[model samples]
Target chain A: MREVFQQSLREVQERLVKIAELVEDAIENATSAFGNSDVAIAEKVIDDVEEIEALAAELDLHAIDILARQQPVASDLRLVVGALRMSASLERMADLAQHIAQLARYRYPESAIPKGLTKTFVRMAALDVEMAAKLVELLRTQELDVVAEIRDLDDDLDELHAKVFEKVLSDKLANNPTGVVDATLASRYHERFGDHAVSVAKQMQFFLSGSLD
Target chain B: MREVFQQSLREVQERLVKIAELVEDAIENATSAFGNSDVAIAEKVIDDVEEIEALAAELDLHAIDILARQQPVASDLRLVVGALRMSASLERMADLAQHIAQLARYRYPESAIPKGLTKTFVRMAALDVEMAAKLVELLRTQELDVVAEIRDLDDDLDELHAKVFEKVLSDKLANNPTGVVDATLASRYHERFGDHAVSVAKQMQFFLSGSLD
Candidate 1:
C-alpha cells in the first residue's frame, strides 16, 4: 500500500517537473515573441497555458487521492503539500507569461526596443529558467545540496531585475514616450515572473526540509 | 502536553489576529501619510512593520513547539500548517505597507500631486482602509462566509485601481508632473495593499474550509 502511494506521489512529481519546464520555455519564448512581435510564438504561449493548467489539475487530483488513500505522514505529508503549492505557483507563472504575450496585441505594433535593452529581459528569463530547472533537478534526484544553492542564485535575479528597471526608465525610454508605459509594465512582468519562480524553488526547499518560513 | 500545545496554538492565533488589525491600520496610515505628507503617520506605519516581523518569528516558534510536543495529526496538522502560511502572508503585507510608508517620506515637503488628481489618491486610501478593515474582521472571526464576501470586495478595488491609472496617464498629470511619478507609484502601492489584504482573507478561507482556488 505504501509503495502504491509512493508511485502516485512520484507520478505527481514527474508531472510537476514537466509543468515547470513548460512554464520556463513558455515565458522565454513569449519574452522573445513580444520583443520581436512574433504572433505564432505568442499564440503558442496561450496554448501552453491550457496544458499547464490541465497538468496542475491532474497533479492536484492525484495528490488528493494519495492523501486520502495513504494519509501521508511527516515528511511524506510535507512532500505532497509542497507538490500542490509548487504546481500552483507554476500555473500562475504560466498565466503571467500568457498575459505578457497578450500585450503583444496591444496598440503600437512596431515599437522597437532600444539596442541591447532586450539583454536585461533575456537575463531575467534565464534566471527564471535556471531556478525552475534547478528545482526540478533537485526534486527528481532528491539532491539536498542543491537546496542551499537555490537561495544564492536568487540574489542574481534580484540584481538583474533591478537593473532592468533602472535601464528601462533611464536610458531606453528617456525620449521614446509612445510605448514606454507598455514597456514599463513589461519590466514588471519579468520581475514578478522571477519572484514566482523563486517561490517554486522555496517550495522545493520546504519539501526537502519542512522548514518553510 | 497536548493541552499545552493547543494553548500555544491558541496564543499564536490571537497574535495573528493582532497582527492583522495592526497591518490593516498600517496600510491605511501608510497611504494617508503619503497623501497628506504626514511624517508621524509614516513613522507609525514603519513601526508596525517591525512589530509584524517580531510576531511572525514568535508564531514560527510556536508552530515548532506545538509540532514537537503534540505530534498533532489530521485536522490539527492542517491547522498549524495553514496558520504558518497565513502568518507569512501577513508578514509580507506588513512589509509592503512599510515600503509604502517609506515612499511617503520622499513625496512629502513638496505637495506634489496635481490639484485635480489628489482626490483620486484619496479615493485609493479609502479603498485601502475598507479592505484592510474587512480583512481584520475576517481574521478575528475566521468565518468562511466573510472570507467569500471579501473575495467579492476585491472587484471594486480592481476597478478603482485600473481607473486610477487610466486617469493618471490621460490628463491627471497635466499640471503636476513634479509629483506625478510619486503619486503613480503610491497609488500602485495602495492597489497592491488591497490585493495583499484580500490574499490574507483568502488564507483565512483555507484555514476555514480548505478550499482557496
Candidate 2:
C-alpha cells in the first residue's frame, strides 16, 4: 500500500512539473506575442489553453484519488493537498497568459499598447518569462532560493507596472483614451501573472518547510 | 470515531460560514466607504483583513485535520477538499474587498473614481454587496438555484464594468488620466469579486451534483 501511495505521489509530482513547463511555455509565447505584436503567436497561446485546463482537471482527480485510497497523512497528505492548489494556481497563470494573448489579438497589426511604452512592457515580459522558468525549477526542486527569486521578480514586475502607468499619465506623452485603458489593463495582467507565480511558490514553500509564512 | 469526525466536520462548516459572513461584512463596509468616500470605514475594513486571513488559515488547518485523521472518502472527502478551495476563494474575495477599501483610503478626502462616474460605481458597489450576501447564503445552503443567481450577478457586474470603461472613454466625459486608471481598476476589483463568488458557487454545485460542469 505504501508503495502504491508513493507511486501515485510521484505521478502527481511528475504531472505537476509538466504543467509548470507548459505554463512557462505559455508565458514565453504570450510575452513574445505581446512584444512583437504577433497575432499568430497570440492565437497559438489562446488555442493551447484548453490542454492546460484539461491537465489541471486530470491532476486534481489523481490527487483526490490518492487521498481517498492511500489516506496519506502528515507530509504525504500535505503533498497531495498542495498539488491541488498548485495546479489551480498554474492554471490561473495560464489563463493570465491567455488574457495577454487575447489583448494582442484584439489589437492585431496594431500593438495593444502604445509605441512609447513598448520598451517597458517588453522588459516586463522578459522578467515574467524568466520568473516562469524559475517556477518550473521551484516545482522540480522545491528550493527556497527559487521561491525568493520568484518574489523578487514579482517586485520588479510591480515596479514596471507602476512605470507603465506613470508614463501613460505623464504630460510629456499623449495617448488617446483607448491606449490608456489597454496599457493599464495589460500592465496589470503582466504584473498579476507574477503575483500568481509568487503565490504558487509560497504554497510550495509552505508545504516543504511547514511554514505558512 | 465516526461521531467525532462528523463533529469536526460540522465545526469546519460553521467556521466556513463565519468566514463567509465576514467577507460579506467586508464588502458592505468597503463599498460604503467607497461610495461615501469615508476614510474611517475604509481604514476599518483594511485593519480587519488580518482577521479574515487568520480565519481562513485556521479553516484550512481544520479541514486538513479532518482529512488526515478521519480519512474521509467519497462524499465526505469531496466535502473536505471543496471546503479548502471554497475557503481560498473566499479569502481572495475578502482581499479584493480590502483592495477596494485601500483605494478609497488612498484617495481620502476625494473619491478615487471621478465625479462623473460615481453614480455608476455606486450602483456597482450595491450589486457587489448583494452578491456577497448571496455568497453567504450559498455557502450555508449549497443550493443550485443560488449558484445560478450568483452567475447572473456576475454577468450584471461585467456589464457594469464595461459601462465604466465606456463612460471613461466617452467623448462627453472629461476625467483626468488618474481618474481613468482608478475607475478602470476599481471596476475590475468589483467584477473580480463577483467572479470569485461564482467560482465558489460552482465548486459547491459540483460537490452536491458530482458533476464538474
**Residue-wise lDDT of candidate 1 within B1-213, one digit each (tens)?**
667777876786787788788888888888777778787898988987898889887886676556544555555665665566667677777877887788777657755455566777677677777777877788677777777676666777777777656765665454433334445555666666766677677767766776766
Candidate 2's displacement at residue A7, Å, is 1.3
Residue ranges of candidate 2 with Cα displaced over 4 Å: A173-175, B173-175
Tens-digit lDDT string for candidate 2 (B1-213) = 778988987887788889999999999999999888899999999878889999998999998988888888877788899889988899989999998998889888888978688888888988888888898887787677888888988898999998998887885434366777778889989988998888888888877887766
Docking level for model 1: incorrect
Residue B205, model 1: Cα distance from true site in angstroms: 4.1
- Alpha-carbon lDDT of model 2: 0.87
- State TM-scores per candidate: 0.80, 0.96
Worst ten-residue run, lDDT, model 2 chain A? Answer: A171-180
Error of 1 at A106 (Å): 2.5
- How does candidate 1 fare on TM-score? 0.80
- A116-196, model 1: which lDDT tens digit per residue? 567776676676667767766876777777766766677787787667546555644444433444555566666667677
lDDT of 2 by residue, A1-213 (tens): 678878998898899999989999998998888888899999999978889999999999999998888888877888899999988889988999999998888888888877688789889989988988998898888787888899989998999998998887876334366677778888988988898899889988887887867
